[model samples]
Target: MILGLHHAQITIPKGAEEQGKEFYCKILGLLEIEKPDSLKGRGGFWLEVGDRQVHVGTEDDFDRLKTKAHIAYQVDNISYWRKVLEQNNIKILDGVPIPNFERFEFRDPFGNRVEMIQEI
Candidate 1:
């Protein structure tokens, strides 16, 4: 009896809300869901990803870390994402082969690792 993911929480530097919006919303094309009034004072916001979400939080002592521990999103078009990322100056790394999917990795605005995969 297992359930699916609720959401994934990531951290960004405090006071970078606009940049976060630019990356997650404008760049990634995720719809921005407004934070509740009770939570709005804390900074950060949410993005709609299917039924789940990606919750970004503000970290006071945030250090930009690049690591393999990341959240992977299933995509419709790798080529489209590739072009989009390139146009936005985001670096894309060809991810290791994993069965029948095309995979890649990139860093978000705050340097957190993110993975994208499209089924072959």
Candidate 2:
């Protein structure tokens, strides 16, 4: 009885929640959804993407760049995203090609690997 993904989580350094919001919300434009009251004190936030969610949690002393673990966002315009990242001084890394898709990767301000992909 398997179902589709409910959410994917990524972490930021503890107390860096405001910076996380700046990147994931102000820059990337993901909508901030209210976290459950019970989880509110845990020091993280939730985001809405289409029908799914991305849970941005908080941790400390973790090196995020050392992992390939990431979230690939489905976008409408890969080129536009590239320019946007570049304009913000975020370095873009070329992604391995997949049939019928164009994509790229970058590290968020907190060093989380993030991918942007679009159907070709």
lDDT, candidates in the order shown: 0.88, 0.95
Clashing residue pairs in candidate 2 (N, C-alpha, C atoms within 3 angstroms):
none
Q: What is the per-residue lDDT of model 1 for residues 1-120, given as tens digits with 9 covering 90 to 100? A: 768788899888889889999988998899989778999888899989998989989886655664556888899898899899999999999988999999899998788889889999
Q: TM-score of every model?
A: 0.92, 0.98
Tens-digit lDDT track of model 2 for 9-117: 9999999999999998998999999999999999999999999999999999999999999999999998999998899999999999899999999999988999999
Error of 2 at 46 (Å): 0.4
How well does candidate 1 score on lDDT at residue 32?
A: 88
Model 1: residues >4 Å from true position, as ranges? none
- Candidate 2 stretches with Cα past 4 Å from truth are none
